[model samples]
Target: MRKLLLRSFYRIYQSVFKMAMPFLPWRRPVLLEGAGSIKKLPGLLEELKIKNVLIVTDSTLMKLGLLDNLIKELGINGCKYAIYDQTVPDPTIENVEEALKLYHKHNCKAIIAFGGGSPMDCAKIVGARVSRPKMPIEKMKGVLKVIFKIPTLIAVPTTAGTGSEVTLAAVISNSVTHEKYPINDFCLIPHYAVHDPELTLKLPSHITSMTGMDAMTHAVEAYIGRSNTKETKKAALEAIALIHQNLLKAYTTPGDIQARAAMLKASYLAGVAFTRAYVGYVHAIAHTIGGFYGIPHGLANAIIMPHVLEYYGSAANGKLAELADHLGIGKGSQSTDQKANAFIQYLKEMNQKMNIQSNIEQIEEKDMPEMISRALAEANPLYPVPRVLFEEELKELYYKIKG
Candidate 1:
């Protein structure tokens, strides 16, 4: 009875969201694309008259000197910038606070998120903190909390996944409780998105595979979810097709600029889709696992996605079959169930070929309860998942993915 009531509430909430979607203040970042797009950002900063900026990234990028060209160009364009390279995977509230300090110290007029999703998440929250100084990060945990205008945020994605460049949601982990949650608001969307495939040219094969699968998960979840708009469905389908064509090529040939560029575009399109349509159980489960075990977000999503989709069973069959048909995965004579199963099998095979583990070895039996609780809290009434899951069903999924 309780589960049924919750399901009804979720459906009503989703319906209301769908009706309000057209009137929402939806915006997309001004895009800069192609091989040399990162180089163009400094000129954009100059044109915006942004003399001081904050660059949020991670130590790995700094070690690789990936920021060298951008840093040099910023100097040439007379844009003074402060660097905060302490962001970690599944960035914490502390990361945002530290970066916010740098933003203030430098009197930054804008922010540049220069790496993968962690840095982008950190930068977005920092901008949110800048916009709402009195409100704590905890208070902004759910939707539409940060309605005020954030400072100009320029997202420069060095990876081909996560789509943090075009997303309005930022996931942040609470270090003390080990809880991961998303803060969603239109205000958090970046003012600019610079896609430079050159930056992703040297991505390690494992990272490439994991991030590509991450983009795939976004596209799949957004397309299968209930609250999709026509525009979002179109974006998700395009992203799905691009990932099908380019992920493997980009993984095998890191220097293949064309493949890398395609994957980047796919990531951006998936971001666009999921930001409005929203993601489902895959993201919800991945966030909890990432928070509890310090697992990489992309890797967690890659492993858990198949399990959740398979568990959704008949509820997800029609959409999954449609995707299978779109990808030409199964014969025309196959039933919807067969096609759906084929699609899930294809993901598993891709994982095997890329050497991605089928199970997350980091997930522990002792952590199952809290993980399920967190995952349920994140997804219920908000995600508009194909099928609503209760405790026992969610627990079964945890067991299935256990190492």
Candidate 2:
């Protein structure tokens, strides 16, 4: 009865949300592939007549000089810029508030979110906060909570994950309370995304492996979620194909431009798919884990994804079989359950290839109850999970990962 009620609520919420999605303004222009594209950004900004811009990034990226090249471009183009490079791994509300102060102090007219998901998420919140100064950031957590956008926001991702460059959602953390908040609104999407593969070549192999799996999780969850549309399936299929063929190559040979480019495209497609189709318990639990334990977003997703899908069992079997077929791992002679099993095995192998560990010593037995509660709170209405997860099942899931 509880599962039925949860499913009913999820379906209704998704139906209403999807009906509204088509009408939402999606105006972001994506620069598909400008090889060696960092140089082109300054020219693009100048052409748009953007003068003062705020670059929100992390200190590591700034030190690596991944962000410095873009700043050099801005300098050469004569665009005045201010940088808030204090963005942490999971950006906090206090972090964003500080960034907002920096933004206002510079009298900035535009935003350039120039790192991985952290900076991008921070930029979105900062942009929304700047436009709707009186609105509480917490109020923007639900669907369509944001009504206005500020300045010309452009996303230039230093890493090939998160798809924050193209998505309409941002996840920010509450520093004091340690809860993660996801803000969803079409208006929160960036004005443009500079998908330059050059910027990601220097990324470490572990990061490449983890972020690639993060993209895969997005595509898989989007494909199997209750709210999937034809469009989302198409995008998800493309993303999965790209990841299956290129993710390993990219992980092994970090400097392979072609592989990195394919990975970027996969991430972008997965982002588009998940934003429309929504994600499931994998993301819900992963977000909660990151909030509570500070696990890297991609690593958490990679860890939780297989277990969640297995828990869903027959509910997600057909979709999983389809994915197995895409990877050419399933023969049509077998039952879909068998194909699904095959698919899960492939996922385990894929993780092994990327050196992803299956167990975490950090998750304690005591944290299981609260984690389950928070996971449900985040997923019950907003995410279209295939199976209605129960508290007992989540506890079991945690035990599996904890071991």
Candidate 3:
């Protein structure tokens, strides 16, 4: 008992010491939330002296009549913009090249990425490429390729997830090789993100469930990440609470504007949390599944979340206990270990309620070795993950989660 108590106190001291160190960096929009923020678009355009803008999105949103609504808003504000709504599930280099072509064709002075991460990522790349036509996308892979000032870029997320609007990192794929590249730069981050929950009310139930779970994963991972700090912990906790309260309401009733708005707020907070603190094995594994199977990014995150949390619980116990208390898990007598497992149990129960599957359809054990390799390849260096795994260990975890 003494040893355990001493270890917990030591861990607490280490966390406090890390918090005192001024290493973790924070970044985001000056202001966030609500419906009428979209009204600020014209002023932003005017500020940038942008007369022409290119909007990048996907066809599903276009067919849903959301595109026409946004067009109406832009017209009311007298913002000149053109639409190139061809962004696909896993946005590719080909998509970036094509969007760049359209940007130059229209003499677009700025870019507005509407929809989820795919469109936002494409727009970031488009913004970068328009400024540097000679620089190959491959050459622009690492940090800070967009050195000089380029076109003004704004992100308007229609979904209550992805949080691509505020993140400095954007992901694009090499289709032929089936590999995803993450581009990190201060310049790629959007100048504005109009997170109107009203926009998300139109999302289907499955989408709402998957995306909400994704936001929840973001908050959880950020709270326990190696790069965590005080501000990030606060953001992650509040975001988790919001998701716990609002996700079910939004999932069952897609037209619930209040629930939709709360979800949007949660996603934005999660973005802020993860932007500085980063993610862990959940994201690392999800990225691999997304690149390989073309699974919706959010669904992949949702499916892998509980499994990864179980693996990391030994390291993340105190944080997980705090998270459980926030979720109202204890009845005043439960130990921290019980609370920690309760949080994992809560997630498992929630996944079942949401109909999230444990098994990836048609992905076999024979493929485990390669999947583990890809997951590790993507996860280790970029992410400030809490726990590190070797190849065999990662492979074992993959099969364990595969069950």
Candidate 4:
């Protein structure tokens, strides 16, 4: 009876979104992709007439000297910039306010995010805060809440996951309360995205595996979710294919330029698709895990992906079968359910090969109720889950992923 009610509710929700969202406007970023694409940044910056850019990154990249060439080019070309390399793993709102102060003090004309998702998410919020000085950044939470367009923003993702470069949303944490809040607006999308594989060559193997699976999760959920368009479907399919072909190679050979490029492309495509289609319960659950436990977002998503699929079961059969067909796994005799299970098995094997754990050691049984409630709050009325998760089911699901 509860499942029936949930299904009925979702049908109405799907109807409203399907009717309205196709007409919604989307932002596209100018993409620079290749081995030496970072060199093009100077010319692009000059073309945009951007001066005194704020570089939002973390200390690790600075320590590795990965930004040396780009920083040198900016200086040699006479573009003034300030570096805020203090962005932590999961960026919080309090520190983003600090970055905003730096942006204002430096009088930065543009914002350049130069690390992984953490820096990019921080930069997006900082841009929003700086753009509308009178409005509280907290008010910009939820969809289309920002009233002002941010300064020209450029993102260079060092990790192949997160797809924070092209996505029209950012996730920022409330550290004190341990709540993860999202800022969703078209204005948050970066004006330009640079996906130079050379920057990704130095990524550790575990990071490559986890982040590659993160991209895979994005593509899979986007393809399966209810918010898909024809364009999103195509991009998602392409992303899935590319990830399948290249993720293992990139994981095994971190220095392989071609494989790295393919993973980057896959991540970009997945981002574009999910930006439109949004993601499902995996992200909703993963976001809560991140907020509560400080688990890396990509790793959480990878760990939760197969379990969500298994839980969704028959309701997810059709789309999962489609993916199986795309992956060349199912023949004529295999049923859709069989194909879906095969896909789930494939994900398990993939995780094992990549050394991704099926469970998180840090998650506690005591926190299960909070996690379940928070996940439900985040997912309902937004995510088009194939199967609507009730509290009873959610508790059981969380138990499987707990240490």
In lDDT terms, which candidate is top? Answer: 1
Q: What is the TM-score of each candidate against the true structure?
A: 0.99, 0.96, 0.89, 0.96
Better of 3 and 4 by TM-score: 4
**Candidate 2, residue 22: how far the Cα is off, in Å:** 2.8
Q: Candidate 2, residue 65: CA error in Å? A: 1.1
| Alpha-carbon local distance difference test for all models | 0.93, 0.87, 0.78, 0.88
User: Mind giving the per-residue lDDT tens digits that candidate 1 earns over 1-403?
Assistant: 9878989999999989988989999889999999988899999998998899999999999999889999999889888999999999999999999999989988999999999999999999999999999999999998999899999999999998899888889999999999999999999999999999999987899999989999999999999999999999999999999999999999988999999999999999999999989999999999999998899999999999999999999999999999999999978999999999999999999999899998876678788899999999899889989999989998888888884
Top-TM-score candidate index: 1
Off by over 4 Å in 3: 1-26, 30-33, 76-78
What is the lDDT ranking, best to worst?
Answer: 1, 4, 2, 3
RMSD of every prediction: 0.8, 1.5, 4.9, 1.5
What residue pairs clash in candidate 3, if any at all? none
Global Cα lDDT for candidate 4: 0.88
Better of 2 and 4 by lDDT: 4
lDDT of 4 by residue, 37-95 (tens): 99889889998888789999999999988999999899888899999999997899886
Q: Per-residue lDDT for 1-403 in model 2, tens only?
A: 8778876877798778778767768755557375678778888888889888999999988888887778788898899999999999989988789989988898998899998899999999999999889998988886788877677889988777788888888999988877886888888889888888888898989889888999999999999987788888999999999999999999999888999999999999999999888898899889888888899999999888888888899999999999999989999898999999999888888898889987666887777777888888888777877877778888888887777
Candidate 3 C-alpha lDDT tens digits along 158-213: 87777777777788878886666677677777877787777787888888888888
State residue 342's C-alpha deviation in candidate 4, in Å: 0.5
